[model samples]
Target: MVGLEMNELKKIGLGLTGFGVFFLFFGVIFFFDKGLLAVGNILFVSGVMTTIGVQSSLQFFTKRGNFKGTVSFGIGFFLVIIGWPVIGMAAEAYGFIILCSGFWSTISVFMQKIPVIGWLFQRFGLNQP
Candidate 1:
């Protein structure tokens, strides 16, 4: 459906923005940093990109009743979670995701309640509920 595609695009945008934050989260190492951590950064970046890509792709391809998005989201989440340990930076990354995801999701949900702003979305012709 067109609506599903749009929603998926939004999610993909969110996920990519989230990955950009992850880069900010872990990209500040000194030149002296070494070993498994360096290795982990590769996986971390890939995981983030992959998740965003899958979500966007699912939007383009998935049907209403299919579980592909759910499965892709789960796998993307798992890849991100597991990639940290492999890179030896699990604690920092994990904490960052929890804080960011929780706070953002909550704020967005709350903002969806305001009148004019919420109504503006309806004005644009997209279903809000």
Candidate 2:
């Protein structure tokens, strides 16, 4: 039962994370609409927290190596909320790349299993492995 609940939670978390990314993409496509960007930021952060748990999320963000990324991300989020979507997204993108560098291998592996997308990644040399 506990395992089942955890699986469900993970599914939900993934959904939120996916939606967050979708919104962020659309936000950019829409010329960095502040509302969409802000919503994307919120959903992304909350989704990450949900997926990793609050304590782990805090630790990950507060780690010594992640300090710069964390600060940048936080400031970016703030800037977006205050109506500076372009610059805010730039900062957030930098921070997000830094913060997620460690997960690239894992992400690549996952991407490699996505059928057509996987083939595209491979063909484009985007597949790390």
Candidate 3:
């Protein structure tokens, strides 16, 4: 069980690291191409910070719970949304996740269930029975 968990962690770590490095490199390229520095920098930093957050999520939140991870992920996601267009594909990808999370988190509070929206919330496990 321990070995299995370690393997899963290693896989997750590699995935997050790869994702972060991809954005970092892309941001650097954008900078060289005279693209928006603010967007590039935001993407670069958010990628790095998000990756670190995910990699350390387990150990960092083992005792504290996943609230911190959720917040960091949320912030990273918000940056991605704001950085898109001026930033590139990396931002869009992360932004989509943030948008989805936002919908999930907020949809449950809605008194009236809108078609499809409520279904999405439940499907994503944000709306409890």
Candidate 4:
């Protein structure tokens, strides 16, 4: 019933997310080509965010998972590396956003919970709220 529907939605989200990642990978493989790499990377990230956002929202409605925004908040880090010489500053800007907001913060949160991780966070002052 409701569970089945939720599962289906989750599947759809995961599928889209996979495609988005594949698109990014494709961009990486063809790094020499500026046009394809830039366009493809942007599209892939956008698609992933959209699908995940939808899934997260649905889960939130059902009181299952909290709705984190679709934007991977920190993907810009990898994007910056991809962008630099290839796509230029614009892409790098996006990369920074992804890095500072999405990935780094999330990992930092998890790190604060583990003993060793917490120590590391304290050492680096990365656990500040």
Candidate 5:
């Protein structure tokens, strides 16, 4: 029962994360709309926390190696909330790249499992690992 609930929660978290990305994409498409970007940031952070659980999320974000990324991300989020979408997004992108660096390999592996995209990735030799 507990395992089932966890799986369900993860599914919901994934949904929220997907929506967050969707909003972020649209925000950029619409010339960095501040409201959309702010909502996206909120949803993304909440989704990540929900997906990983509060304690694990805290540990991951607060790790010594992640301190810089964490601070940058937080500042960027604040900037977005204050109506500086472009600059905030730039900072957030940098922070996101740094924070997700460790997960790139895993992400690449997952991407390589997709259908047409996976074929293209393989053909292009983008899946280094």
Candidate 6:
């Protein structure tokens, strides 16, 4: 997204930024053996990041002029959340996040091929799409 449109980039940036934090936070949570208090902290942080990620992904879907991706993102996002306690493996729970996080990174690195959308995903590490 180096020389791409700012508006579109922003959407992708938001998703990448939010998803990055989400993964970092979730990974730490899993990497550690904490008590309920720690779980509470993860819950709080995840809640905030989830909201931000959703908003960003929504923008990308909307800007790309695709409602299906937006809807899928929403469903996938919620599934990631709802399936948490039921899942035995923390990695499995966290894997849901990787979908968006990995996708954001992948799209960023390949921005040239996908055009506007790719540029937006790449904006995550750069802090701007």
Maximum-TM-score candidate: 5
Error of 5 at 109 (Å): 1.4
The regions of model 4 sitting more than 4 angstroms off are: 1-6, 32-85, 92-107, 111-125
Q: What does candidate 4's lDDT look like per residue over 1-129, in tens digits?
A: 644454554666566656655655665676634544456455555554455565654453334221222232233334444645344434544533544453677777787889987998899988777
lDDT of each: 0.48, 0.88, 0.50, 0.53, 0.89, 0.47
Per-residue alpha-carbon lDDT of candidate 1 for residues 8-118, written as tens digits (9 for 90 to 100) = 546665565565555544544532133333434445544444655666545533545334434444443454445433333444454445434526656655665778765
Q: Give candidate 2 regions above 4 Å deviation.
A: 1-12
TM, every model: 0.24, 0.82, 0.28, 0.39, 0.87, 0.28
Over the stretch 43-129, how does candidate 5's per-residue lDDT look in tens digits? Answer: 888898888788999999999998888888888999999999988988888898889889999998988899998999999999876
Q: Model 6: per-residue lDDT, tens digit, 22-114?
A: 554664566532332234334443444454455654465565444444455445344345543323234434444543553775655566467
Clashing pairs for predicted structure model 5, backbone only: none
TM-score, structure 2 vs. true = 0.82
Per-residue C-alpha lDDT of model 2 across residues 46-119, encoded as one tens digit per residue: 88888877888899999999998999889899999999999999998899898988899998898889999899
Error of 4 at 99 (Å): 10
- Candidate structures ordered by TM-score, highest first: 5, 2, 4, 6, 3, 1
lDDT of 3 by residue, 1-129 (tens): 543344544655556556555655665576523234334445544444454555454554342444444455445445545554334444444544543453654556682377787677667876664
Highest lDDT: give the candidate number. Answer: 5
Error of 2 at 118 (Å): 2.3
| Clash total of candidate 6 | 1
Minimal lDDT window, size 10, model 2 = 1-10
Residue 67, candidate 5: Cα error in Å is 1.3
Candidate 3: 10-residue stretch with minimal lDDT: 32-41
